[model samples]
Target: MRHPRLCAFLAWLYGNEATTGRILQQNQIIFPAIFWPAPENAPLDPDAVLGTFQSAPATSLPEVFELPGQTYLRNLQKISPGLWNGRTYCMKAFDLTEGRPTLTCSSGHFFDALVSCDLLEFELLSAFGEVMPEEEAFPEFCERLTLRGTLHALGNPLHHACGRSAAIGISTLIIFPAEGVYHVLLRSCGSRLAYLDKFFHTVPSLMMQPMLADERMEYSVRHNVYREYLEEVFGAVEGEMPYTPAQYHDIYADPAIQYLQNREAAGSARLLLSGVAMDLLKLRPEICTLLLIDDPDWWLTHRQRLRPVTMVDSRCGSAANLLERSPATPLYAIKLSPELELPTGLLCPERFTPPGAAALCLGLNQVRKLLLYI
Candidate 1:
C-alpha cells in the first residue's frame, strides 16, 4: 500500500476501546444493538422500521481537501486495482424518531467523496504530531474536526456538514433454524478494501446504490437486500444498465427470490431490521438486519446449491463461471442449544467485521425472543 504508515495506524485502531468510547460518547454504537422492538418483543414490521427516503442534491468533500484526498485514493488503488468507482446512494441525513428511521440521500460515486473521509481523518490526526500515540491523538482529531460533536448534536452521523459522501452499508445475518438449533451463515471476505479477509455475515454486505432509474426501487432496502442475496449466494447475473421494466420483473421472479418472499408471507421466514450504526474505524453507516428462515427443509434441500461468490470475484471476471469460482468461503453453523446460547470454537468474535459481529449478536437476541412464542 502507498500509505504504509496510515495502514499501520488503522491496524492499531481496529477493535480499539478508545475508538468505541469515542463513538459511544456521541451516542452512536459500533454494533447492531439499537432496535425499536414492539411491545410483545417481536421485531417491528420491515416497513415500520424504515420511514422514507427523501431526495436531495449530491454533496462532495470540501474543495480544500478534495485534491489531497483524491490523490491519496489514487495511490492506494494502485495496489488494489480491483477497486471500482461506481454510482452510490450517499447518505445526507439520517433520523430515527418514534421508532421510525428515515433517510435523506443523493447521487454519489465510490470515488466521489465517501472513501476519502478516513484519509482526511488520518491526515488531520497526523498534523498534530507524528510522535503522539493514536489513542491520545484521536480525541484531538475529533475536537478539531468536530465530527463527533456535530453528529451528536444533529443526531445524524452522516450529516452533510461532515463533508463526506457517507455511503450506506447494508449488512444482514442469514439464519436457518431446524428442530431446536439455529445455523448462521458467515463469509470470509478476501477483498483488500474494507474488512479485508475478515468474517462478515454471509449473503453479502453491500452498499446502497441506484440500480435503475426508478427512484422507489433504488431506495428500497428490501429490494437491495434481496437482490444482493441472489447475486452473492446464488451467483445470479445482474442485468446491465438502461434496464427495462421487464428486467426487474424477471429478477423478482427468480425462484430463490420468490421462495424468500413466499416464506416471509407465510410467516415461516422473516427479514427483520436489527438496527443501524457507524463503523468506528471509517465512520461509514451500516444498516444491520437479520434474514431468519425458520424452516430447515430449505437448507436441507439447497445446501449444495448455495454457491457464494467471493468478494473479489464479484468485482472482477476472474472465473469463467460460477462453478469455476473458488470454493465457497468457510461456513460455520453454530448449533444453538435449547437455551439458544451460541457455542464457542465454531466462531471467533475477533475475526468478525464489527457490523457483522453486531448483527449476529442482535439477530440472536431477537430470535431467542421470537422462538419462545413460536
Candidate 2:
C-alpha cells in the first residue's frame, strides 16, 4: 500500500493542481513560542530572565498596561540599544510616522538579542511603513530601498537571508482578531522576490514537516507540492508567465489568509528565516566559503575593493551570470557533480569523480569562455 500522502503529492505535482490561497487560508498558521533552555546542570532563574532586561532602554520606570490579554511596555524603552545584546520590546500609541502595526527586528549580531528572552517583545511600536499590494507597483508615496546588488558584495556575502534580517524595512506582527494565536506575518513595502531564496534556504534545516502530527499528512503534502509546483511553473528561466507567479504568491500569502505557526510549544524551534539574506535577517538571520569573481567584461566597473572569481560552466544554473549582473560581490559556485566543477582546485574535487560527466561538463566551460571572448 502506498502512502496516501506521497500519492496525493505526485498527483498534485503532475497535474500542477496546487494548494490554492483559499486552502492556505483554511489552515491555521501559528509560530510556537520558542525558548532557549537555560544551560544544563546550572540553576536557571526565571527572575534572571527579567533581570537581563536591567540595562534595557527604558525612558522611565516600566509602566505595565493591560490592554487585551497581552502585556505591553509603554514609553520609548530601549530594551537593548545594541542588536546583539537582546531584543527590546516596547509599546507606544499608534503613530503615523512609525508606519503600520508591524513586526520589526534585525539580523547580524543585532538579532542575537531575541534569544535571551521572549519577554522583550514589540507591542504596538507604531505602524507607518509601506503597504505593498500584490497587483500594485510599489507605492509612489514612499521611497524604495533594496540591498539587491550591495548585499551580495559584502565581506560575508550571505547566500540567503532569513530570521531577523527580514525585518530591515518591514514589520512582523500578529494581525489581531483575524485568526489563531501568534499569527506572524511580514508586511514589506515592495516585492521581496530577492529575499525569498535566502529565507527558504534554511527550510531544509528547520525540519518543518516532521514537526507536525501524523494525521495532517494530507495538508502537509499538498502544501509542499504547491510550493514545488510553483517553482516548476514559475521558476523556469525562459517562459511567458500568463500570470506573474511572484505576484500570486504574495497576494495569496497575504495576512488576510496566511500566518506562520511555530512548531514547538515552548518556542525552541529555530525555523524563523524570514529576514536573513537581503538585509531582512536582522528581522529574522549562511553557510559556504566566499569566492571572488574577476570578470572585467561585466557591468559596473569599480575599484578593486573586491575582485570577482570566474566560474567554469556545468549547467546547474551557475550564480556567475546572476552575480555578475548584480551589485553582489565575492561570487562563488559549488559543483553539484563532476559535470559542474570549474577548473579551480579551491572548489570541491570529488565532483569530477565521474569521468564521462566531467567531459560533458567541460562543454559548459567552453561556452562561458566564448562569451568572454565575444
Please give each candidate's TM-score. 0.73, 0.18
lDDT of model 1 at position 354: 49
Give the alpha carbon lDDT tens digit for every residue of 1-374 in model 1.
Answer: 11323333333333342212222111122331122222334475544444446565655455555666667688668877766676677666656555445456666777755445455454534543454436546545445544334333544343342567677777787878644566666665643343234444545578877766775666767878887888776767877764577886777888888888888899888998766655544556667778889877777656666773232311322212221344454444445657665544333323445456556666766777777654
Residue 365 in model 1: lDDT: 68
Q: List CA RMSD, all candidates.
A: 7.7, 25.2
Q: Give the lDDT of residue 120 in candidate 1.
A: 45
lDDT of each: 0.57, 0.21
Which residue runs of candidate 2 sit more than 4 Å off their true CA positions?
1-300, 312-330, 333-374
lDDT of 2 at 166: 20
Worst window of 10 by summed lDDT in candidate 1? 19-28
Candidate achieving the largest lDDT: 1
